[model samples]
Target chain A: SAVISQKPSRDICQRGTSLTIQCQVDSQVTMMFWYRQQPGQSLTLIATANQGSEATYESGFVIDKFPISRPNLTFSTLTVSNMSPEDSSIYLCSVEGGRGSGEQFFGPGTRLTVL
Target chain B: AQSVSQHNHHVILSEAASLELGCNYSYGGTVNLFWYVQYPGQHLQLLLKYFSGDPLVKGIKGFEAEFIKSKFSFNLRKPSVQWSDTAEYFCAVNWGGADGLTFGKGTHLIIQP
Candidate 1:
């Protein structure tokens, strides 16, 4: 398993502003996943970031709203643009446990509060 | 639509009491099952997983789950409960591939000391 970390552990932003959350992994990984956990809701996947490719966004989530950049295997960034009150949630980044390892290791989540 | 379901929304128990939380999913393919626990103020951590092999799999902290493919259920169990075990438990499933995990509405477990 790789050690993962997320920057700006928490933040409070205006409804129209944007915030970029960064995820850093201690070791290189193949695929990185971004998830959103709303209050009292299940975790929903936002996108999958693979190095050297365009990020794949899930249904109901668009790249324009959640732009991601995966420069290398060990790092990725998710920017929540044109934020709204509904966008306030915990954003987390994770890596598949490892090759043939089915588990996933997650980073300390980024708590975003849109006011 | 593929979804994971945790039947118990909230569960309360005392120390030394038996524990079991139900989880079921709608997917009908080879899946990788996982149980993750999130303690207060902490990130989600893997408790155990079942890809293949024995239907009964043991995990960390005396936790275990049985993968009953016929019933589309993989329920978590522990012989005894402790206050430290109080946390939100989430069940997840992923078809063997690049698909992202589908998680259940977590079960909140509160163990009284």
Candidate 2:
């Protein structure tokens, strides 16, 4: 299991402001992912942050609204750009277990509330 | 296009009672199933996972889940409930891709002592 940590555990921001959430992993991983959990809703994959490459986003999400950067193997960042009230959610970062394990270790998650 | 469905939204049980939470997935071909538990103010933890072979898989905290391929269902069960078992349980699936895991709506379980 990987020890993952996210910065800004909880934050309240005004609408139209942007907040960047950071994810740091204890070990080097090839695959890092971002997910969102709205109030009383299930987790939805936002994007896959590839080391040294552009992130691959899901269908409903786009790069403009949620830009991601993965400069190295152990760190990644997801920026919620031009936020709105609807963008308030818990953002989590996860790393896949190595060697085709298919298991993922998740971060504590950044709880963002837009006012 | 894959999706996971959790049958119960909320369940309140007494101590020493049996517990069962149903989960079903809509996907064809090979897939991996997992059960994750999230206690209040804590991050998600993997309870158990079923990749292949045995249909029954045991997890931490004396929780277990069975994966029935024909029914496309992986239901979690516990013989006796404990007050500490109160948490939100989520069922997730991965279909051998880079898309990441798709999760269910989650079932909030409450065990009253």
Candidate 3:
């Protein structure tokens, strides 16, 4: 298992503002992912942050709205740009346990409430 | 797109009763299944997972889940419950790709002692 931590555990932002959530892993990892859990909804994958390349986003998410930066294997960031009330959700970062383990360990999550 | 479905949105059970939470996936290829639990005011913890080999996989806290390929289901079960077992349960699936895990709408369980 890996210990993952996210910065700004909880934040309140106004509409049109942007917030960047940071994810730091105890050890180097190959895959880091960002997820969003809206109120009363399941967690949805926002993007997969690649170590030196641009993040790979899911079908419904876009880079312009959620720009991601993975400067190293142990750290990544997800920025929610031009936030709205709809962006109010818990943002979690997760790291793959290891190669072929098919397991992921998650952070405590950054709870963002946009008003 | 791969998706997961959890049958129950909320479950209320008394202590010492048998428990089963349903989970079904819509993927047609090789997949990995997992059940995660999030206690109130705590992070998500891995309850159990099924990658391959035995159909029955046991996890922490005496929780277990059986993977049935034909039915495309991996249901979590515990023979007896405890008050500490009250938590939100999420079912997730991964198909070995660049994509991340897809989760279900989670089941909120309340265990009455």
What tens digits encode model 3's per-residue C-alpha lDDT throughout A16-84?
Answer: 999999999999998999999999999898998879999999999999999999999999999999999
| lDDT (C-alpha) at residue B109 in model 2 | 98
Candidate 1 residue B76 C-alpha distance from true site, Å: 0.1
Candidate 1 lDDT, tens digit per residue, B1-113?
Answer: 88899999999999999999999999888889999999999989999999889999999999999999999999999999889999999999886655578899999999998
Q: Candidate 3: which stretches are off by over 4 Å? A: none
Give one digit per residue, the lDDT tens place, for model 3 in B5-95: 9999999999999999999999878988899999999999899988889999999999999999999999999999999999999999988
- Model 2, DockQ value? 0.69
- State the weakest 10-residue window (summed lDDT) of model 2 chain B: B93-102
The Cα RMSD across the true interface for model 2 is: 1.5
Per-residue lDDT of candidate 2, residues A1-115 (tens digit): 9999999899999999999999999999999999999999999999988898899999999999999999999999999999999999999999997656567889999999999
* Each candidate's DockQ: 0.65, 0.69, 0.71
Which digits, one per residue and each the tens of the lDDT, describe model 1 over residues A29-111?
88899999999988999998999999999999999999999999899999999999999999999898765444688999999
Runs of candidate 2 exceeding 4 Å displacement: none
Model 3 chain B weakest lDDT span, ten residues long: B93-102
For each candidate, give its TM-score against the true structure: 0.98, 0.98, 0.98
DockQ of 1: 0.65
Tens-digit per-residue lDDT, B1-113, candidate 2: 67899999999999999999999999977888899999999999999998889999999999999999999999999999999999999999988744589999999999999
